[model samples]
Target: MTFEEQPIDYSNYLPDAPQARSVAAEMVATRQSEQVKAALFSAKQFPRDQQASFNRIMQACQRKKLAEEAAYEFPKGGSKVTGPSIRLAEVLAQNWGNMEYGVVELDQVNGVSKMEAYAWDIETNTRRSMIFNVTHERKAKGRINKLDDPRDIYELTANMGARRVRACILGVIPGDIVDAALDRCRQTLKDGYTEPLTDRLRKALLKFQEKYGVSKEMIEEYVGCGQDAFTENDFLKIAGVWRSLSDNMAKREDYFNITKVHVPSNAEEEFLKLQEVEKKEDVVHDISTE
Candidate 1:
């Protein structure tokens, strides 16, 4: 047949010709299966040593920064509730060995996203998984606002997923180890404040004011003590509150009872300026002015 008379084979273009979707799915399943098999074989070959893992976790918790961020304290029902933070949980899982942990977004529909947080003990074949739904909205100041931006939705989902992932890891890990890590973190925080107390207090006050719009007066009201009366224990509690606030583990209202922040008057501003000058003069050496 001449080239002009060649037949057009429409089979390739037919609706069901290649089954592309099924083929792709099969490939994905096969790859996932291979990964699982490899993970299991490797875990079997090299198992985790419990004592070594414990030491590693405790050592990791000894770092001042990690220990500082290790736990958050929040008030509930007229009592304080404290627990290991997500950062600490993640450290534990990493050192625990032969573990798989992650959060995955399975689907999003109708302003709600479905996600799964999972942790697996590869050597022991123990697994914990939690599936939950996150609504793409946030309640703030008695207002319910819907999130429409992609970035906002992603951040909301990730934040929610992180808490769930933390819980899953905690579920699989031993309780005693987590408790020990918390204790170590507490000691680290207690001893980590090597700077001058005045300097630490200044920085903390500035931070709380700048970050949360909380004034020194508000803090005094909350703690029932003025700045001069503040002790090392008070500073530690403030640090815990800061960590809790930074991680979104608790709200300002939960810790402070301030409904309206008072604006300083002109006289108060002048007093603060005088206080600052005196504070600076206290550190400055007396040099004779000729």
Candidate 2:
């Protein structure tokens, strides 16, 4: 029997080596270059109609559901942070025409994820990209816990990537277009829904209470008016606050004064009862001894 020595492929172990990394990088670069060329050719052949694009964006924003989710609000430094939401940005990017945008998780190493989000305008050859890192950690009850579970890491990465992707898309799209879409969304929300205004308001009250322990009274107080007097603008603001909470962007306490009253569990109740009995006995003993 004879043994033959085989050459080692260092590329397998050393990804940073020129032979390994450069080849892969070149392949990716070539593919992306072809895509860009194709997009530019298509754009030249069929240019975007600005008015049509504007109308499409406005029409999408006019929908009640889209309008409801068009913007988000979060509290920061004793002030409110409000802006167009990722959902709205997606709609804008899609309707804006001749634009391409997406987010990609490039790599993960040492409990951190490297991600890239980009938006490119094929017609004007305008491009925007954002590279960001997401740390695999979860904060709960004022404590930071490192995430070991793949599902948790993936979800956290996705949520953070969405905001970056939104930023890139918005960067490529015109500011005026985004503004017009937001305005349309506002008007759509203000116009009220097919359901009666009272019914919708009641549902919103129930939703907030069930989801966030926010009572109708708290909501009224926040808006400085009762539900009956709640204006369209007030409802929009409430929706924004809800978006902030749903996305975990802010806590309920940030926007509302949530007074926590500890309810006794069975164990706690028994402990309290035992304490009361002990106190009674001590009181009786003190009186007799005196």
Candidate 3:
């Protein structure tokens, strides 16, 4: 009996195909039980459903958490352009499998150089693309790696496009508890029903670590709201004190001291002392400006 002719597999032909990679990238092959335990203990107030999602997100963060996974500061206009823009190549390389596939291409049309990049995420099946104007309207001639060769432009845009893909997969780039909190704060601000630190105003507060100084014990001791019920405005005095700070002023310990005492009570003496100090400083400022 003649065997039927076997059909060509064509399946392994496209190595660049997104479907070729494991649908679920292998997570870190370890469990941070202690971290999870601590988080769960602190998050007992979260509803059962959310705790599960939090657990998954936290674990992914730990796995992808590179030592240098730092946030990119938005550069100010007129800042020196000493080098190419910040690139997250290392971050994407470390988490390459997290991405399904990506494409980078460059073109020049009528003297304008354009670069485009696209990154795909299987988890969300989202496509993130970035387009950059390399020369805009400049002579488009005799520029460094970017305007001349343009490969660098494609790669640079690809790096940013990868970050967007990672965000789709992880729900946030630089995935960590800090970013998680910021996302929540942003959502709360969008809702506008609660919280003094609307997303925009939060940048004016002290640096990230000092923005909310109340220790866990202080929250438990002084706060009436349970953990899950707690919102940014819950620290009424803390929010109020920082709200009064001049623009971009570094936070001072004077405000954090409020955490040492119960809220709204037993804190009057300290509050008065702070008010007196402010008045004296204001008087000194008036004399100095003369």
Residue-pair clashes per candidate, as listed? 0, 0, 0
lDDT of 1 by residue, 129-245 (tens): 999999999988999999999999999999999988999999999899999999988888778877977789889999988778788988887778999998877888899999888
Residue 219 of model 2 has an lDDT of: 82
Model 3 TM-score? 0.27
Judged by lDDT against the true structure, how good is candidate 2? 0.87
TM-score: model 2 vs. ground truth: 0.76
Q: What is the C-alpha lDDT profile of model 3 across 203-235, one tens digit per residue? A: 323332344544444434434444445555443
1 versus 3: better lDDT goes to:
1
- Candidate 1 stretches with Cα past 4 Å from truth are 1-18, 139-143, 209-221, 224-231, 259-290
Candidates in descending TM-score order: 1, 2, 3
Better of 1 and 2 by lDDT: 1
Q: Write the per-residue lDDT of candidate 2 for residues 1-290, one digit (tens) a residue.
A: 99899998886675566777889999999999998889899999999999999999988987889988899988789777788999999999898889988888999899999999889888998999989999999889999999999999988988888898899988989898888889999999878567776887888889987677788777877788889998768877888888888878888889876664333556887999999999999999999999
TM-score of each model, paired residue for residue:
0.79, 0.76, 0.27
Tell me how far candidate 1 lies from the true structure as C-alpha RMSD in angstroms.
6.2
Residue 134 displacement in candidate 2 (angstroms): 1.1
